[model samples]
Target: MRLFIAEKPSLGRAIADVLPKPLRKADGYIVAANGDTVSWCIGHLLEQVEPEVYDPAFKKWSHEHLPIIPDRWQLVAKRKTSKQLAVLRKLVKQADQLIHAGDPDREGQLLVDEVINFLGVSKEKTAAVQRCLISDLNAKAVKQAVSKLRSNQEFIPLSTSALARSRADWLYGINLTRAYTLQGQKAGYNGVLSVGRVQTPVLGLVVRRDQAIESFISQPFYEVWAQLETLPEDGPVERFQAKWQPSKQCQPYLDEAGRNSSKPLAENVIKRISHQPATVMQLARQHKKQAAPLPFNLSALQIEASKAFGLSAQQVLDVCQGLYERHKLITYPRSDCRYLPKDHFTEAKLVVAAITFNSGASKAATSLFGTNSEAFKSVDIGVKSRAWNDAKVNAHHAIIPTQKKLNAAKLTSTLSAIEEKVYRLICRNYLAQFLPAYEFFDVKAEISIGTGIFLAKAKEPIKVGWKCLFPSAKPKAEADNTDQESEQKIPNLHIQQGLKSLAARLDEKHTSPPKHYTDASLLAAMTGISAHVSDSELKKVLRDTDGLGTDATRAGIIELLFKRGYLRRQGKTIFSTKTGRAFVDALPDVATHPDLTALWESRLTAIHDGLSSYQELMMPLQTQLKSMVVDSRSVVPHGLRGLGSKAQYRKKQYRKKRPRKSKSSAKV
Candidate 1:
């Protein structure tokens, strides 16, 4: 018999659907008429053993065992899922050949491979063990993947990298958490000072942003604007707005740091340009084209969902997963690649047809490319676009609609409000790739009034194109320093024509502090942190590596911080708690900085590429653990120090407000 093991039951059923069916369903698995058995793991059947499982003495927290590095790592079946593991083990023993149908990633490779190890199956004993990599859960994609299975040995390096990462996290998180918690207990606080390789750095980002906002001091400045009317030969006088630009020597509104700080100089400029005749010195018009946005990667999707629907990062992930696994509406949801493989153009056409008349997307499709028009009938998804580059594709392509079509009424009735919204987001983005680029004309006019130069500008849309699909989507605002006149409509005027200034006024404005981070902006920061690093080599390495965590894990990491009481949410904005801020202050830069995690990721990449060994990476991490333990031993835990007084005050108030236990209860 041949056996197939999948990462999840939904995926296993998807695989089973594609094979020759008439499957016999069992308690935990299904066997096909062709003698192929299919089973699944909820996720991971086994996990690394806890500290107590290593040794009883190590269970008690002590500074002497500060850095607990196990001589030999161990794994045990998760108690809740052990029954399913038993079923898989029995099948493994009976089968002569095995097939691994896990997700196409390092963690996925480890998930199935670990089960094989647990069942004590060896390559010498089994006839053959093969690996199948499938990204989409659709029947066609699964069938194609099954026909091209490769040897499991080829993914051993990825498995090794995964193990190294798991062990490194365990060593760092377990030891550091215990050390900090113990220190806090000694200081009269009661709470676990939980830490992780990625969570601490994420917390640091929020705390620093909050500090910057609190410390900011606003400075006032001014700008002068003129309401002018053109001397026109055409209909009605062409009225427009213009902003005055001070000369280099006369400009004093900006301080040394280039921040707005002077109102007097602005007032002087207003005086000079007021009640003056202006001549149009230069008029220029330029045509521009903006291509459609790239398809959704996991991070980009999360950011967009957070902004559009006010959904949390975790909520977006959950919805996308449901669409991918349960509904079969979209492809793999945890992808990082924003581009599709060149050969996928054929597949793209199939997906486009599937969503052409979807629940909430039919109107967008019909409007962008008229329902019965030639453009709609001959929709060209193979237009040599930037979104179709093979070099940009990594392990999986971007999140796209699948070729599995469903009835419009069924879709609308089955999906929740958020799911419908997310599904449409994917559809519109994918459909946009086939439409013409959005076109516009930018007009700029410079007027001369005495020694001052006034500027007027406007944008005129030539063609809506892909933008017509999203009527509700707003254009991103220009930078703060951008000329306000550029955002206004400019009346038609000839060069060298004279115009009269009706009114001139100086408007005072103050420098605003940085905005608080919402889930949207935080995800952007986490994924783009490498761009802020000073070291060129480290930045390059980090760019190649996932910035903080894998797409599969970043949302969970953020969610964990909230559960641990290190982060608090107000409306859509996220702020670090007092405990979180003090925790960052107490830790050394080595522990809190993102650079350390980036370095580890770089090493993990090296291991993946066969340039370095897993043991090589582990040795350095173990050494760092020892040094961190020693350094942390002398440090005091001040995270909860500030909260001590608040705790005491609350306790006192509770005692005073407490009603004495009723005499009736005592008698009972």
Candidate 2:
């Protein structure tokens, strides 16, 4: 008998579809005619036991019992999945061969391995376990994966890395959260001042930004626009706009950003250039090409969806999960790698066909980019873009549409309005790879007028290319950065061409403070947090890592902040609450710094790559934690006061809840 353990039931069914059948549904598994069986873990069937499980004395939160470190970590079946676990234990004993089919990532690797170890399968069976990695759940992809099963032992390092991450988080969160919550209670704060390895640093970002905005003093800046008209040289006179660029001689009067800080200086430039002869000092048209943006990785998708639809990060992730598991429309939804495996290029036609017909219609009726086959008929499937690179592909390839053929009705049955929008968004980005590169001419003209240099810039589109697929986007695509810059229509002109300044327009503007964090911008900040840190050495190390959390956990961490009353949203803008600001301001640097998290993430990656061991990463963490807990005794956060206070209750106080009489009256 052969037994297959998959990460989740949806994945299990996908694996089973390509297996030997005359398959019958058993209690918690499916049995094939050949006595082969398939079972699954519901995310994780077993979890690390709580501190109380190690010793009864550590159950209460007290300064004496500060850092609860379990000497020998243990796992027990989660109550909800205990039945499924029992089924696995029975099946594992009867099987002659075993196959592990987790989701081909670090957490997926650990989920099943933890189960196998908890089930206490024999050493021989464990040693002989075969690993099957399936990123795409389509019949063809699964079949291909089945033929390429490798030894499970090869992925032990990946499992170890995930275990280290899990334990490190547990140690950091459990210890510090308790320590801080206790200190907050001492300072008369009623709520739990919860802190985590990732959540606190994220909240700190918002708190600091708010402070910066509050303290910022707006300063006036000036720019002179030259309304220049070209000389009639074998053609009708044409008018163009240009901005007065400050000369090097004007350095003393300029601000650090090279903006004209002195109003008199800017007025003088406008006065001198008002009726001056303008000669073209430089005329350059540089041809450029921009390839399509790569396919959706979880973080990228979350960020884009948030920007486009005002959908929250958690909302986008939920939609992607349904698209991956329920509809089988996309590949794995939690991948971080943006590049696709080179081999996926072979199935471009099939995937394009899926998108062109199977995907539902566009949300906006007037939008040029629709999901109908006619909309994508011009897509050249043979034109492979730079997205397909074997070396760049990580544990899982980019999230893309699977070639599971579907009709419009089937898609509508599977997707909601928001789901459809995100799905179409994913499909459009994927189809873009087959389209031609967006070609344009980068135009720059520096006008010499009365000893001052005035510059004009414009992007002349040579061909719409891939941008045609995303025409008229309301939120504006990230790749289409033309909106962020000043541009004007430019005509053919020769060097030293004579032109006259029609008029000088002085524009006075105030320097605006930084924009508040939104779901889209916050996610972007988290992914590129290296910019926030001060140390050069730490910044270099962090640049190699994804700043704060994995693609799977970032959304949840942000949502968790809101749940803990650390953040509030007013429309699309995310702000730190008074409570949140107080908590972050009082916390130590280690608890609020993203650089340390980046270092930990890099070491975990090292463990995954087999360059480091679990002990090497975990030993120092335990020692550091012990010191933090000891300090937690005297570290009463003074800022935890002045917000309306209430009684602080222990964790066990919420063991039972009063039942509501009516469904309508129930808190959702």
Candidate 3:
């Protein structure tokens, strides 16, 4: 009997539907009349246990028992999926051949291997272990995957990488969590303080941004603007405005004795303008142009959705997952590539045709350039870029609309605005790729006003180009930045039309501080391209590394921050909790610095590319982690030293406020 194992049950059923001959489906297994059988594990059927699970003595919370490292960790069935696990164990025991249909990545490999090991299946006795790679969980993908399974041995390196990563996380999570939790309890804290290889550094980012905000002090400044009107022969003066001399850049316009004015800049600019007529000094003009956005991938989608609709990373992920697994409308949802495979253009066209009739995509489809057009062929593929490597592409190409087709009417009216925006973005980019390059006319006119030079500019789209894909996608806010202006083109105007100033008004503005970290912005920052570090070589290394975590894992990492009460997002900005800030304060800056994680990532990539040994790359981190355990164990406050008196007072007030309940209200 051939037993098929998939990443999730949905995928298993998808495969079952495509198998040849008579297919019989069961609660836990599926059988084909030709005798091919399929079953699945729910994501992960087993996982490593905590240190406490190995020794009861390790269960006690005490600083003395810090760094509770386990020897020989055990793997047990995930509690909620025990029944499904039992069924899989039975099927694997009796099967002659096995097909691993889980995801085509490291974690997926581990999931299948762990199960096989648990079932005591000897590799030598098994007929074969085939790998099934399906990107979009659709009938066609599943059918195609079954016909082309590769031998399991071919995936050893990938699985090894996954195991190494998982084990490293386990070692850190288990050791540091126990170490910190025990220390916190010793210091009279009620909640467990947890840490992870990724979480600590992520929290560091939030805390640092908040400190910058709190420490910032606003400074007042002044400015002046003069308004003027011009004759119609000069084209209505184009609303002339003026800039002050060098003295205006500073606060030198004080009354007698250089005393600065207490009045606001708006009042001052108006007063200065009312005193005299403005004069023309000089005119300057320059031309500018912009290009269309590249394409959509999982990270870009999440970033855009969060900006456009205020959706959390996980929420966008869930929606995309559903779109892939249930609706079969798109491909994989965890990739970072923003470019399509060169050969996938044919498939891209079919997918576009599928959505154009139902959704607002038809208008975009009509404006699309032909697939064979030179305009579509100019995009740089960067053949040497890792992001574009064919070998790195697994089950699916990047997250793209599938040729399986789309029916916009089938989409629910209740679909989130974010979902609509992201889907449309995909369609627009795909369609734009085939369209003529968007052309624009830029007009620049310069006019001098009273010893100052000024410039004016505008852009006019000469060709709608790919922009016709989603005419409605013009500028939206907070999470999305799509609009006619965002597309690069030239403004309509000639340099020699003569000029005229219709009107001019002085405007006053304050220099604003850096904007707070929105989810989208925070995601970008965590990638660790820091300028503070003195080592240019290290900075370059960090730039080449993956930021924070992989796309497949980043949502979970952010969710972890929420779960641990380390961070929370209000609207779009992410704020660190008091506990989170305190945790950051407790850890060494360099230890939790984003640079370290970036360095680690760079080395890991080097290991993968054969530029460095895995042992050399990992040994330093392992050593650092051990030193961290020792240092943290000795130094963290024993009784909540960092939380300050507010927490204590809150606890006191809460205890004092505990009121007696009415007898009838007491259920016990």
RMSD of each: 8.5, 5.7, 9.7
Which order, best to worst by TM-score? 2, 1, 3
For candidate 3, give the lDDT. Answer: 0.61
Q: Highest TM-score: which candidate? A: 2
Q: Write the per-residue lDDT of candidate 1 for residues 192-297, one digit (tens) a residue.
A: 6777888888898888889999999987866677778876555578787877766677535566555335677776767777778888999998899999898898
- Writing each residue's lDDT as its tens digit, candidate 2 over 1-668 gives 98889999988888788878788987779988878789998888876666666666666777778787776776666667788887898989998988999988899998898888777778888999999999888888998998998999999999998999988998998889889888887888776677788898899999999999999999999888898897776388888878888878988988878888889998888889897889998999999999988898899999988988999999999998888888888989988888888888888988988876775453431242543334466789788999999888757888898888777677766678788778877887898899899899998898899788888888888887888777655554553323433346777877898899987988888889999999999999888888877678988776444578888889999998987778999999999998888888778877787777777777888888898899888888888889878877778777877552434333432222222221111000
- TM per candidate comes to 0.86, 0.92, 0.75
Estimate candidate 2's RMSD in Å.
5.7
Q: What is the lDDT of residue 460 in candidate 3?
A: 54
Clash pairs for candidate 1 = none
**lDDT for position 221 in model 3:** 42
Off by over 4 Å in 2: 359-375, 474-486, 642-668
lDDT per model, in order? Answer: 0.77, 0.81, 0.61
TM-score of 1: 0.86
Write one digit per residue (lDDT tens) for candidate 3, span 292-395: 56566676777777775787888889988877777677777766556555555545546656555435323322333222333334433222222233554544
